[model samples]
Target: MYLISGAECFDPSPRGQVDVLVAGGQVIAIVEPGTLNVDAEQIDARGKILVPGLVDALTHPCGGGGEGGFGNRTAEIDVETFVRAGVSAPVGALGTDSIGRSLDVLYGNVMGMRTQGLNAFMLSGAYRVPAPSLTGDIARDIYLVAPVVGVGEVAIADHRGTQPTAQELRRLAAETQLGGILGGEGGTVLVHVGAGDSRLALLREAIEGSDLAPSVLYPTHVNRSTALLDEAADWALRGGFVDITVSTTKELIAAGDITAEQALRRLLEAGAPAEKITMSSDAGGSLPVYVDGELVGLTAASPGSLSDLLRALFADHADLFPLALAAMTRNPASALRLNAAGEIREGTRADLLLLDPAHGVDSLMCGGNWLLRHGEYLN
Candidate 1:
């Protein structure tokens, strides 16, 4: 058992000076400050912040893709980078390339993260229609597969996508949403936003015309283009969550369209609900700068950007309560169906991060185990 005190906790909401107790891999209790008097070792939060560990709701955790043969595929990441970034939980997703993306590979990736002490799960498909499936049907896989949540990153509006018709998209969404209900999880249909002229027309049609609740559509990479980002904001206004990728936001800032700081501010200013926006580092994924279909430049996502986004949010005077932690924690928890995850509350998993609020990650804990202490790995 452990007692973590002296810091405010963010379940994406402010809980002042909470003494969080952990045991048996779950957060057993949250006591009044100084409630526990055991000689049990105490780790101070240092008046910093204690938030439910950040969640990367969407990522290609097993090294995203290889548009250029096996050599082009990025290598899989280990536990160190994730913990360092304050990502105690991650929801893996498959990107555009699907040849090497197999259901078996996806399952192994989720289990591998669990082995290394992370809450891991995955969406079942890439950006294709007749979308890739482990059980031959989206709904079946969602109900039958353990880690499967919903179908995703189904590429729309991009040349790379299967360019699913509105009808096809509707069918997929209906199946996914139903499956999520049956499985008692959120049936989030993932979409990968690309910089195409059509923008989010297909998505809009799906929402406007279909019976599915708008919240079920989880679109990501909104910052890839200014127009796309705006479309994402509109989606949020219409009650859908948007995934603003860290690197894509960086590119936007570089182009003067908006800073990562501004992109967030815009989301809030638009009166979009706070919980409707989430962020992720497409870590272990490729960032290709394509010109005329020739890959001119490419960069793999760095784990540091997630921290950079959070730090930037704090630096920009953004509210720390919901803004700082939810994008990383509760929002993902709600979007993906990971109960007993997200938040620093009773009966939740003990995936936690302790920060200086001024500096950054000082210690990390997962499943009641101190994986990181004083900025160093315990084991």
Candidate 2:
């Protein structure tokens, strides 16, 4: 048992100053400062901020690369990488190299991470049209597999993708919905929006032609281009969700394309509901660079970039803090149906981070176990 005292909490909603009780892998209670007197180890957190640990929804935990070649395949991500980055939950998915990196490998990594004390889940399918599945069907994979919460990271409108038609995407989403209904989870189709000129046209048309709710299709990499970002804003206006890639924004900023801050600002300025937007790190995935339709080079994304982006936002864009925090925490949790995770409230999983004065991770607790203390790793 532990008592975290005198911290400004953000249940991702700014709960002012409070003390949180942790026991048995869950938040036992939240009380006023100095109000709880119990037998527990005392941890003073004066002048610090407490926020929910991040839920990165689009990571490639089993490794995601090989566009350049087999030699260029990125290595698998470690549990410490995410813990140090203040992420307690990481939803794994496959990308372009789904053939080499099977769903079995991804599922294994997810379960392995869980055994090592992380809230890990995974998506089914990849960038291909006929998405590869363990049970030979995506619906069965979601319904039967406990860790398989949703479908995709499915690539659309990209040169490397199988060029699945709008109808095909709709059918895939329907199948995911069916599985979700049976399994009692959100049947979200995590689409990888590419740089192709289609620019979310398929998703919009699918929504128009089908009875699926706009919330079922979640497109990522919406910040890859101005046009796509604009379309994403419109999608959000119509009650759909959009995901911005943290590593992609950083890479684009490095290439002198657009800064991370501006992409989010543009989305908000274009009437995109901030609550409807989410951010993901795409950690361990390949950031493949193409020139005239040829893979020239690539770089693998890392875990800390999501934390880095949040710290930067707190430092440079204070007004976006609440929305940004919710994006990385609560929003993804809700979308993926991660019970008792993502929020720092009583009866929830005790996945919390204490931020130092500089907004960096000072301490981290996942499932009532201390992973980091005083800015040092303990596990």
Candidate 3:
């Protein structure tokens, strides 16, 4: 057992100074400081802030970025990167090049992370209508594959995308939701809304014309353009979840019509529900620079960007810090149906991040084990 004492806890909602107890890879108790006495290892958290470890809903754990060429395919992300990024749960997906990279490879990578003590998951398909599936079917993939939560990073409205019709998307969403229903999880379709004139039209059609719930289609990269961001705000207002991609590269940031910071601000100003918004690093994916609809240069995204973005948000947007934290943690967890995995509370997983006074990650504990301490890796 472990006792994390005298820390300000954010169970994502400010629990004041409290003590949390952990045992057998789960949080067992939470009480007022100095109120609980136990014979267990102690962590002095007097000057720290404890929050739930981040849940990255969109990432490329098996590696992405073959846009430039085969030589430019990014390297697979290591377990150390996820720990350093303070991500306890990461949902991996394929992007533009799902051909060279296969679902089997993605599943292997996710299982590898699990072996290393990370709560890793993956989507079944890539950026195409006829997505590559491990079980030769999307529903079967989600139903039979334990790690697959949904189908996604599927592209739309981009030149590189398959330009799937509304019927195709509706069918995919229906099957995904069915799989989730059968598997007792969120069977979501993670749509990659690209920089095209069609915008979210296809998505809107797919959701509105079908019996599928708005939650069935989770559109990401809504911050790709100011117009798309505005549309995303409307989508959120209508009770749909929208994801903002936090880009680390200057080229990708510039490629977006607005910065992630600006996009968040815009979403709030547009009156979008705080709980319906999420931020992802798009890590390990390609940040390709397109000129005249052609890929001229490419750079790989970093998982560390998730932590960096949260730090920057807390430092600069104090008023929105709580909402921002939820965006990175609880909201995405909820969207991806990661129960008892995103918040710090009794009965929840012991996946926590202890932040220094500067709001930087100082220590990280996942599954009741310390993976990082004093800004250094312990395992």
Candidate 4:
């Protein structure tokens, strides 16, 4: 049992100053300060702000990269890195090199995170058509695999992608929808929007030419280019979710593309619904630089980028900070259909982060256990 006292709570919706009580891995109660009479380990959060633990909807936890070669494959993420990034729950997926890494290994990484006191789930496939799955069938993988909530990081409109046809995409979305219905999961087809000339065209065609709802397709990395960002805003206004990657560098940002903060501002200015936008760190994935169709260099992404983005938004856009925070928390959870997460409420899972005066992660608790305390990793 743990008690967090006198923290300004943001159930991701701002609940003012309150004390939160946790027991048996669930948020059992939240009341006015000094109202709790329970026996538990207490943390003094008088000057801190409490927010729902971040849910990273897209990350290469098992490892991403490989565009440069086998030696360039990124390393798997550790539990400490996630805690430091204020992420209590993260959804793992495979990126460019799914063939070299097995679904079994990805599933094992998910389970390992669970044992380390984090709530983790994974997508079923990689960035290709006929998505590689443990059960060979994407639908079966979702329905039979408890940890698999969707299918994704499937590439489209990119030179690195499989160049799947409209028919192939329609079939994929249909199968994923059926799997979601049967498994009671989100069953989202997480499309990796590329910087190709045909950006988002295939996804739009898939939605229009088929009976699949627009919500069935979730396109990520939409902030990679100005044109793609505009299209993403339009897509969001039309009731689809657009994910912006926070793992960007100055070089990428200088090339006429916007940062995650800028993307949020543009989406809002363009009349896109707040709930339709999400932000994630493409953690442990490769951020490669392609010059004239040749991969010149690669750098690894970190989950820490998510935290940095949050602090930047809070400082630069204080008025819209709450809404931007939702992109990191509530919106992604809603998009992923994760019911018990993304908010601080009684009966929901006790995954929480405490922010210090500098807006850095001071402590983190997942499943009612403190993983980091006073800016230190407890484990």
Model 3 lDDT at residue 155: 93
Clashing pairs in 2: none
Candidate 3 TM-score, true structure as reference:
0.95
Candidate 2 lDDT tens digits, 1-379: 9999988888998889999999999999999988988999998998888999899989998888887779889889988888888889889999998878899888899999888888888899999888888799888988899888888898877899998887888899999889889888757899998778997988988889689988889999887778888898999999988888878634465544344567678899999988888888899887766776666677778778878877777787879887888989998887766676789878888898988758588888888888888877876
lDDT agreement with native, every candidate = 0.77, 0.85, 0.86, 0.87
Q: Give the least accurate 10-residue stretch of model 2, judged by summed lDDT.
A: 249-258
For model 1, how does the per-residue alpha-carbon lDDT over 286-349 read when each residue is reduced to its tens digit?
A: 8666666665666678666777677666666657435746776787787776775678888878
TM-score of each: 0.91, 0.94, 0.95, 0.95
Q: How displaced is residue 340 in candidate 4, in Å?
A: 2.4
Instruction: Point out where model 4 deviates above 4 Å.
Output: 288-297
Q: Candidates 2 and 4: which is better by lDDT? A: 4
| Deviation in Å, model 2, residue 331 alpha carbon | 1.0
Across 184-207, the per-residue lDDT of candidate 4 in tens digits comes to 876888899888988888888888
Off by over 4 Å in 1: 68-70, 249-257, 288-297, 316-321
Model 2 lDDT at residue 36: 89
Minimal lDDT window, size 10, model 3:
248-257
User: What are the runs in model 2 whose C-alpha is more than 4 Å off?
Assistant: 249-251, 254-257, 288-297
Clashing pairs in 4: none
